[model samples]
Each structure stands twice: as C-alpha cells, then as structure tokens.
Target: MQTLRSRQASIAPLGIVLATGALLTGCGLAEDIADSLDTSNSKLHHVDTGAEGKESGLLADWVPDDAEDVHVLQRTTGSERLLTFEYSGGMPSECLEIDTVGSPTQEELAAAYETDARTRDFEVTQWSTEPTMQAEWWSAGHESRTTHLCGRWWVSETEGVFHAFAAELNG
Candidate 1:
C-alpha cells in the first residue's frame, strides 16, 4: 500500500505554486486542490491509532480525539495526504470529490481544534464562519500550512522531503 506522506513529499512544491497561482487569480487554492484530488477508483483505508496500534507520522498526532469515520486516501503526490474524519452522526448524501468516506460539518470541525492549537510547525491562524467557514494555519519554517475544506483537510508544505510533513496532516 502506498503511503500518502511519501506521495506528498514529491508534489509539495507544485502544490504551492498552484495554490499561489490560484490565490492570485481569485480562484481559491482549495478548489484547485479539489480538482487534483481525483476520486477515480480511489481506495480508503481505516486506521486504528489507539493503544496497541503503532500510529506513526502526521496522522498519529494530528487526528482529533473525537474524530469519527476516520479514513485515509493515499495519493501519488505530496500535497494530497488525504486524511478525512467524519464527526457527524450520519453521512451526508453529497460530498466533494476529495472526501473519502463522507463529509465534515462545521460544528464538528470547530470542536476539532478547540483543545489543541499546535501542529508540528504551524499554528491555527484562522478559523471563522466568515466568507464560508474555513480554517488555516502557518508554519514558521518553509511557510508550510493547511486549509480545512468542506468535509476533509488539505495540506501544503514547502520544505525538504524530510521536513515536508510539517503541515501535511491536520485533522
């Protein structure tokens, strides 16, 4: 099974450029990312990170404690370390192409970072209901960060492969 982290390590740079380009054109970075996250025959796997399960890497520390229906989609590029967690009681009828299992709710997302606000490098810099509910963070090194989407999370890291995961998985 291919790992999402490894894939992200390869495409981090391109994602940054595209994200910046999209931002400049008022198209939005997340939309571009969503377009790139192809759902064709994509497979999602559930992980048990609880005790006795050796959870490693970004997902090990970033997934929220209350997150449910946690699933991961492995991609071929470094910017697509798709880790989706559903907190709502039931699944939504419709979801973005990037969503793995279902979708995410704003209220559930709000509770995700209510307790902890620190990731490996960046910190939660924005989280509000203005202009559509969204969340963003910034990194001290390489400017790596993440942006919360409708029912999932997207990471964009701009650093060496060894440190590329600093902002790759933020549940």
Candidate 2:
C-alpha cells in the first residue's frame, strides 16, 4: 500500500511537468503566429488640444495665431509622420497661407495630403474630403527632408468659421 502511494505521488509530479512544458510550447507557437500576422509597423497617433496643441509644433510654421480652439493630431508609422491641425475662428484666407518656402510640385503635395487623410479613421469636416487647394512647404524647424501642408476652411451660418489642415513629414 505504501509503494502504491509513493508511485502515485511521482506520477502526479510528472503529469504537472508535462502540462507545463506543453503550455509553454503552445504559447511560443501562438506568439510566432501573432508576429507573422502583425501589420501595424510601430504605428502611433497622438492628440493635443488647447495650450498643449500650440506648443506641440506639429503644424511647424503653419500654427494659426488667432485660433479660438486648437486640436492637433500627430500620427507616426515607422519613420514617417503625418500631422493634422484643426482650429476655430481663423479666417479662411489667412489659414490657407503656407509661409514656409519649398515648392514641392502640386502633385507631390496632393499625394501627401491624400495619404494623411486616408490613414485617419476620424473625419475633420470637409477637410477629410477633397481639398479645395493643395500646398507643400519646407519646414526648416524640422529635421525631416520635407514637410507638406494642406488646408481647407468652412464658413457657414450654422457651423461657424473653422479651419482644418493636414501635413506630412518625411524622414
């Protein structure tokens, strides 16, 4: 009877060890599968508002001076970055101006603008749709090779005055 009891204890430990080994192996396999299917290449999005939005510098030289409410979005995938800025109470003419000086062809600018808007899941009024004008400028403030900016404005009796902008920063 004592021998039987000893044998039972030894077998119980062996079973526990086998189960643990199997669990660890299954976890490793699952992790490998997950890594193979992973598509987000270090993508990240950041939002800033109010005073923080002004200080974020995501808009580079295009940050509006008289904006009543400011919202900024910065999205990054690997080394590439896209910045979108939205503000209220800014004049349409003033908001559309790009002060920085690098003339990337209109096509290039439009491509960057389209890419920025396409990657975003959220809507920014009409700005997410086809922009009335496309623009690109070089931001000396940044270390990127080039930064492109696109903007749209809305002035309606119901919606009030608003400005939306999108920029692409290439590393």
Candidate 3:
C-alpha cells in the first residue's frame, strides 16, 4: 500500500507540471498569432513639419528647396516604408523639374497612396480630395538602394500642398 501511494503521489505532481507547461505554451502561441494579425501595432511613425521637416533625412532628398510650411509623415513596417508631405511656396510646374515619370493614373495613385491602413488617417487625405495634378517617380538609391515614389499636388496662387508616398522597391 505504501509503495502504491508513493507512486501515485509522484505521478500527480508530474501531471500538474505537464498541464502548466501546456497552458503556458498555448498562451504564448495565442499572443504570437495576435501580433502577426495586427500589423499597425508593429508600424513606426514619424512626423516632422516646417524647417525641421526639411532637415530630416526622410525629407531632405525629397522636398524641393523652394518648399515652405512643410509637413512630413513617414511610416515603416519591417522593410516597407510610406511617406506623405504637404508644403506651400512651390510650383506645380516644378513637377517637371523633379525626377518624375510624368502624370500618374488613378489606379497607380490608389496603389501608392491608399494601400496602407495608417496612411488613411493622415491629414494629407483632406488635401488629396481635389488635386490639380499628380506625378510618379522612382529613386534608385546608391548601390543596392531602390525606392518607388508617387505624389499628388493641389495648387493655388499662394500655396502648393503636395502629398507624396515612397516605398522600398526591392525590400
């Protein structure tokens, strides 16, 4: 009787330990799945406006020298990146001077600008509703760097607001 009771005691504790381990593992797996499904949780966003915005590396190579009241928003998820900006004091005609591929189609614009969920919330959406013109461009950075750029602009006599998007083409 004593031998049987001792064996039973050992088996009960072993069962408990196994059950606890299984529960912990199940919880961990559930958490991982939730993280994978919620991409916004993993995204990184950066906002810069005015002179500081122009100085940022994100905007420095992109924004025109004549731009003013600049507002820039950048979002990144892993290797993917999206950029949008608004500025005054630049000419719509300047699109020709930039390294653009000429006017963008409605489908191309949607793919570049509307694909990201986070970008939908940006203030630039308000300005994009009625753009005077739109352009698309590509920047093949030095060596192994390549990026796709697209943008739209609403122009007036005193202000020219531009909303642009950029993403890594190879990444």
Candidate 4:
C-alpha cells in the first residue's frame, strides 16, 4: 500500500467549537438560521407592495391555488417563494418556501428586495425538504433546471418581518 501523503481533512475539535459559536450567535431561539438566508450576502424585506409581487410568467406547467390568507405567486422568471400576501384574516400563521428560477444565487434575488424601506434589518434563507434535480437552459445551452423551495424573512432587533411572513406563507 502507498504511504499516506496528506492528513485527513476532518473538522477539528476547535474548528467545530468556532463553527457552533458562529451559528449560535443570531436572533430568535437559535434555530436553523440557514433556512432564512436566500444567500450568504442577502436579506429579506417585508412591506406592503401594492403590485402583484414576483413576476411568475416563466413556469412551464404549474397551477397554484390561494392559501388561507396568502395567495401563491410563483415567480417563473426566478424562484417561487416570491408570492403575494393577501391577509384577509390578519397576519399569516406560517412561513413558506416557493420555487424560483434555476440560475443565479438566491442572494442576488434578495438584493432586489433590499430596496424596500419596510424591510430594513434582516436576512433571507432558502429551505426545502422535497427532493430536487438539477435542470439547465435547453436553448441557452445548459444542462438542467434545479427545482428548490425558498423563503425570505427580515431579521431585526424586534421580531416583526419574519413572524408576519411566516404567518402569511403558512396560511
């Protein structure tokens, strides 16, 4: 057998400690915060945009129905999490992760939302439990189109943005 040329790259005890500490240093009950970031360098915004919100004209074959107080707006041009919130029963009751476009980082999409003044302090994360596949642009000379669920929530000194967004999406 050949001699080992390099050391294994396993997480060291000290490295683990630092990682854990960094992960734990956030707002809320210290849950899985990664689920809220659309990307590492982006955040979510929550405000009353009168527009339909998230242009969803690219979906191939999809039919979404309105949930409790929120209406699903799948942005075919990008991810599906970009939907409309029609709160008839006051604030929503759960968070949601909609599908969007395949390419580009979620952080890019999140940066688009930073323009909103209603959403000043917070971040966005994408979460999904369903199985997904990598897809690509057929005519554009790509391989596959990856389908994933995403969410956007604003974090702040006070729990206002994410809480309401979760409520809307769940319903």
Candidate 5:
C-alpha cells in the first residue's frame, strides 16, 4: 500500500509539471513573430492582411504585400512548420493564387485547390484576428453568418507542404 501511494504521488506531481509547462508555452498555436521587412536576413512577415495578402505578396514582394487588413501566423506539426495567412477584404468571391518556392508536393497544392473549391459559395464579409489570424464571412440574410469559405493558407518548407484549411465555423 505504501509503495502504491508513493508511486501515485510521484506520478501526480510529474503530470502537473508537464501540464504547467505546456500551458505556459502555449504548446501549439504558432510562434508569435513580429512585422518585418523583406530583407536577405529575415524570418517571417505580416501584410496586415492574411491569405489574400499571401497571394498578393507573390505578385509583388517575396514576402507580404499591400496587405492592409490581414494577419499571418506560423504553425508547426511535429517536424513540419508552415506559415498561415488569414485575410478579409471589402470584396467577395475573390480567388487568388500564391507562388510557392523551396520544396512542396502536388498533393499539398491539391489541398489548397480543394479548400478554394469548397469556399466558392460563401460571400466573405468580415475578417478579423491578430497574432493568430482567422477569416470570417457572412451570408445575405446572415442565414449562415459565418462561412467556412474563410480560412488560412498554411505553407512551409519544413514539411514541404502547402494547404488551405477552410475551418468549420458558423455564425
């Protein structure tokens, strides 16, 4: 009985310590980087606009471009890491593409295509969020105020993957 009690007490403290560490570090929500310029020696950059800005960034700067209302974040899964951009604008049914560099697979590209196809019907209205950006949209009569059409594009070289996740959400 004493051995069992000792084991339980030791395990309980260990579990609590691990949980505290995880919460303190925010386990997995992407790194909290900062706004940056397109320089040779740089990490990540935000365009104040999210996914749309990512597409536009490809058209102009190697990073983010003219993104006025967008937020970008970086997420990781195991050994993989991807930059996620969430965007909202004044227009609807806007479809844009982003040029990928480094290494990625065709399946990754297909995921992005699938995401776009699914979101075609939703009329994007408002997109707001920072640090970790999220896209939001609404319908005509607000039947479904928030639509899954609003999503973030996750891309990264670590995983050699690029995908758009139209998160399941409703308003």
Candidate 6:
C-alpha cells in the first residue's frame, strides 16, 4: 500500500499542472486582474489642453458660443464623472471665470481657488452660500478684482477685469 506521504507527493505535481494550465489558457488573467485593481493617481491639469473645453457630454455645451480662453477639466470613475470649465467674455459680464465643479464635494476646488487668489495677492472675501444655492467669493487688491461662484450643480469664479469687456460688448 502507498504511504500518505507518497500519495501527497503524487498529487502535488497534478496541482501544479492544473494551475499552469489555467494560467496559460486564461486569456491574460494577470493583466486583467492588474487593470481591475488599478487605482492610479490622476492630475486635473495633465489633460489635453486643446480638448479641455471640447468634451462631448453633459455640461459641454452650456458655455457660450463666443466664449474665449476656455479651459476644461474632467474626471471619471465608473459611472461617476466630474467636469469643470473656465472661460471669459460671456453675456452681460465678460468675466474671467470658472463655470462649475461637478463633483460631490467642494473642498478641493475651494482650496484651489484660494491658492490662486493668494498667489495674485488678492484678498479673498469670505465665501457665502445661503439664501441662494450659489456659493460666491471675491478677491480685490490693487487693480484686480475677481469673483468665484459655486453651487451644488454649478460653480463659477470670474475676474472682474472682464466686466469692462462685457460693458463694451453690451454698450
């Protein structure tokens, strides 16, 4: 009769063969697993500069046909997506502004705006989001004044310098 050790040794080779066969015939299982587990970092500014304002879905068309200096940022994960747009010279006010933050939270976006304001030596007034759904703030220093706006579905930040351009256009 075969001893227990002998029987176990005999099955070990069979296990290796079966595992190897599965891997060989599994249509790149390793690659598929790696891709599914991927959680790589994404930078908003790394997207194509030209393609920024030209994305084809959701908030893409809301920008004016004549808007200038248009910039866009988008992030997608499975069924969730976030989109942001910035442009200048729109109706009523030709303000240099960001259009929206389509994410669920506004912390990162607010921080970015504050950083920009600080860099420009503009004092950012407290942001307010009450009575109306919009959250808005401004920066004013020297010859520069700017406004930033955001809401649950939309947010816009604009440089007041363009108000003159808007008045010129409307006048």
In order, candidate lDDTs are 0.37, 0.39, 0.41, 0.29, 0.33, 0.34
| 61-94 per-residue lDDT for model 2 (tens digits) | 3345544443332233322333334456443342
**Which lDDT value does model 6 have at 107?**
53
Off by over 4 Å in 4: 1-11, 27-84, 87-171
Give the deviation of candidate 4 from the true structure as CA RMSD. 18.2
Q: Report each candidate's C-alpha RMSD, comma-separated, in the order given.
A: 20.9, 14.0, 14.3, 18.2, 16.0, 14.8
Q: Which ten residues in a row have the lowest lDDT in candidate 4?
A: 162-171
Candidate no. 3 TM-score: 0.30
lDDT of candidate 4? 0.29
- Candidate 6 lDDT over residue span 14-119, tens digit each: 9998878877998677667876786743213223232444454333333444444333222223111233333454322322244342221245435433433222
Best by TM-score: 3
- For model 6, give the RMSD to the true fold: 14.8
What would the per-residue lDDT of candidate 3 be over residues 56-118, giving only the tens digit for each residue?
Answer: 554533355555544333333322333344556453333322222333344544444453443
* Candidate 3 lowest-lDDT run of ten: 137-146
How would you encode candidate 1's per-residue C-alpha lDDT over 55-140 as one tens digit per residue?
A: 54435443444544455544433223334444432222222222222222444444443433332133333332111111122123
TM-score of each candidate structure, all chains considered together: 0.25, 0.28, 0.30, 0.19, 0.28, 0.25
Clashes per prediction?
6, 0, 0, 28, 6, 4
Give the per-residue lDDT digits (tens) of candidate 5, residues 1-171.
579889998899999888778768886422332223223221333454443555654221222333243332222211111233332322223333333332223443343334554333543322111123222321122212112121233222112112222222234
- Scored against the true structure, residue 138 in model 2 reaches a CA lDDT of 16
Which ranges in model 2 have alpha carbons more than 4 Å from their true place? Answer: 1-51, 66-69, 78-88, 92-158, 161-171
lDDT of 1: 0.37
Show model 1 residue runs off by greater than 4 Å: 1-43, 48-54, 58-60, 88-171
